[model samples]
Target: MMEISSAFASGFQGFQRASDAVTEATVNINQQAAQSSNQRALETPVESRTGPSMEQSLVTLGSEQINAEANLKSVKTADEMLGSIIDLRV
Candidate 1:
């Protein structure tokens, strides 16, 4: 069905978005890790720790991984459906 192609496209887009988010989360984690505690303390007040913390970045990374997996599954399902359609036609 036409929906199969649409599902494949949607899944690919979702996977791309998840991959980008994972990259951003990794970058945020690296930045947070690279910044010295002393420098952060001096620059930001105790109450003003506005940037993403290591825990949050890690969580984001995990969530994005799950999202990517789900998207990949959708893509595989679409591929299978397409293959079935071709087989039936033949």
Candidate 2:
């Protein structure tokens, strides 16, 4: 009986660790996304034939990047929530 309880406890701890790892990874991804956006904001467009202004291009690119980041955050949130639920079950 003691051995069984110990095994169950060990498994639970492992599950908790995995949840923590996922949370860490999600945070890191979010940080990277924010940094990438900042870098994009600082980038200047190369001289080209008259067309859209550099500011306009930057705006469009930034908007697309923001949308992508939002989607990624949503996915990470869902994954974190799922992990929490699983941890609770365990």
Candidate 3:
């Protein structure tokens, strides 16, 4: 059905976005960590950094992981519904 197909597309897109977001947040965290270590090694003053804090990035990662899970579930539900429809028709 159109609804099921749409659900499939929506879920897939949502999952992709969440995955990208998680990846971005992870990269940001890693970059910040690397900068910190490098700074400490050099014994230089902490450079002014402008961006989401580590805590915020961690939160984003956590929330995006949850979103990815929910989107995967939605895709699975849509697939199951499609399968049930085919089973009924056949």
Please give each candidate's TM-score. Answer: 0.85, 0.46, 0.97
Worst 10 residues of 1 by lDDT: 41-50
lDDT tens per residue, model 1, 1-90: 889989999999999999999999999888776575656768954454568888999999999999999999999999999999999999
Query: What is the lDDT of every predicted structure here?
Result: 0.90, 0.54, 0.96
List candidate 2 stretches off by more than 4 Å.
44-90
| Two-way lDDT contest, 1 vs 2, winner | 1
What's model 3's TM-score? 0.97
TM-score of 1: 0.85
Q: In order, what is each prediction's RMSD in angstroms?
A: 2.9, 13.8, 0.6
Tens digits of per-residue lDDT for model 3, 1-90:
999999999999999999999999999999999999999999999988898878899999999999999999999999999999999999
lDDT score of residue 57 within candidate 3: 95
The RMSD (Cα, Å) of candidate 1 is 2.9
lDDT of 2 by residue, 26-78 (tens): 55555555655776798844333344444454454555455555545555555
In candidate 2, clashing pairs total: 0
Candidate 3: residue 75 lDDT (0-100): 99
Clashes per prediction?
Answer: 0, 0, 0
What's model 1's lDDT at 33? 67
Best model per lDDT: 3
